[model samples]
Target chain A: MQLDATDRQLIDLYQRDLPVCDRPFLDVSRQLGITEEEVIGRLQSLQDHQVVSRVGPVFEHSRAGASLLAAVAAPEQQLDLVAARINRAPGVNHNYAREHTYNLWFVMTAPDETVLEERLGELEQQLRLPMLRLPMVEGYHIDLGFEIDWEALP
Target chain B: MSTCTSPSDNGSTLDEQDRKLVLATQAGLPLVSDPWGALGQQLGMDHEDVLSRFQRMQETGAIRRVAAVPDHYKLGYRFNGMTVWDVRDDAIAEMGQRVGELPFVSHCYRRPRHLPYWNYNLFAMVHGTSRDEVEAKAGQIRKLLGATSAGDTILYSSAILKKTGLRLRKEKATS
Candidate 1:
């Protein structure tokens, strides 16, 4: 999808620290010197194009609940079936197929550590593969908010 | 006005009201002139209260930031790589922070090294418009790690099977 100047500017500017106010869009419009309607319209359009996933708060999972990244090496023949089963578990939120021996990777979050382990154990038994539970020990660089110089990068 | 002055004030333990607010905005804030006001109406709180509470949440590191999360793929970042490094345990803290500061690296964390099978202790996620671009970014990290990194691997994601923001559920509901 091609991005216009406003689209790029809005994305770069609003990626972090959106104003918290009654008329947040109005404040943004004032900064960009665009109308509030235009600001809202561009965001809506960006979302429609799937460029902007959403405008909201990114919650801290560990604080909100207990979460861990777990992976299993599904046999090539049963990759789809295994992945489907893993996804069915409510605790499993993000699941991905990465190129590696431990191919099926996912993140599971539960109310507490005990439940998290139980769910992971169940997945291991059902999938018939040893699940590698890699819990987060610490975060080194946590701020994902990037100052995307879109024009600079290809 | 309780502003979270320290990073330690992580909004982990939430009251009923806090949970309701988090649940309401999990999808995304509505695009309206008075989003907080609308939210307040839904939660039966004043707009000012909603704004103040949310600000505190951000200050506490419970909320990373209130912003537009751009889908990298839609923004032309087609390739994504999970770059793992087997850095010396003693040097990982310093090295991981350095690798994470690189603009292209999104998430950098120190996870348990499940060995004989998994040896990488430090994981960093890098995104690029092409595979070459991603590899080049990883190369920069390798250069940064220098000899401290025993080895490294870049796992390119082939598919995103499922992705949903983590939602907290109350009670001992076994899955």
Candidate 2:
């Protein structure tokens, strides 16, 4: 979907630090020189087209819960089955098939370490495959929102 | 005020009310014009109270930002690569910061390496419109790492098996 100037501007402007007040859209509309309804409508449309996933608070990774990056080298034939099984676990949020021997990679999170560990253990037993558990030691950048090069995007 | 909190003390500062707020908005804020008011109504807190709690959370680093999250794939950033680097342990902190500051690098972190299988400790995600673009960006990072970098590779994601961001289980509230 091609975003017009207003839509692009609204996205770039409000990707971070949206106003914290009643009628936040009103404040944003004023800045965009459009009515509050227009802002809401455009956002709604953008969402419908899957351009904008959602407008929400991004919680700090550590502050919210415990999470780790994990990978498994599922056999090529059973890759889809393994992925479906991994996705069934509530904590397994982001899973991907990467170009490597250890193809299936995912991230899992739980309320705390104990629960996260228990879930991981159960998953390991269930998969019966050697899994690489790579927990983050430190984050150099923690999602301050990426700068979208409008020209590059379709 | 000290803003730095250790990862080991996860969720220690958040009280029951804060957890409620987190649960309420973790998925996404209501799309209504008066979202704070709508949330206030749902949680039985005044709109002003809801706003203040979120403000406090932002100040304390509990909330990174409350904003629109764009889908990279939808936005035409089709190629996404997980660029991994094996940097000298002594230079990792400095090198990771430099690599993360690059415009193309989205998420960068130092993770533990499972020796024999995984030699890379630093991971930086690069996204682009094509494989060549992503490879070029990875090349820039490779140049940046220089001598401190032992080896590196880009793991291009072939498919998204699952993409649910995160969900705080309701059962955890009772725990």
- Fnat across every predicted model, in order: 0.81, 0.83
lDDT of 1: 0.84
User: Across residues B107-146, which tens digit of lDDT does each residue of candidate 2 receive?
Assistant: 9999998899999999999999999889999999999999
* Chain A TM-scores of all predicted models: 0.90, 0.90
In candidate 1 chain B, what residue range of length 10 has the lowest lDDT sum? B166-175
For the predicted complex of model 1, DockQ is 0.70
The digit string of per-residue lDDT tens for model 1 on B61-105 reads 677788888988777787889999999999998998998888778
- For candidate 2, the TM-score is 0.92
Query: Which stretches of model 1 miss by more than 4 angstroms?
Result: A143-149, A152-154, B1-9, B170-175
Q: Alpha-carbon error at B123 in model 1, in Å?
A: 0.7
lDDT of 1 at B29: 88
lDDT of 1 at B76: 75
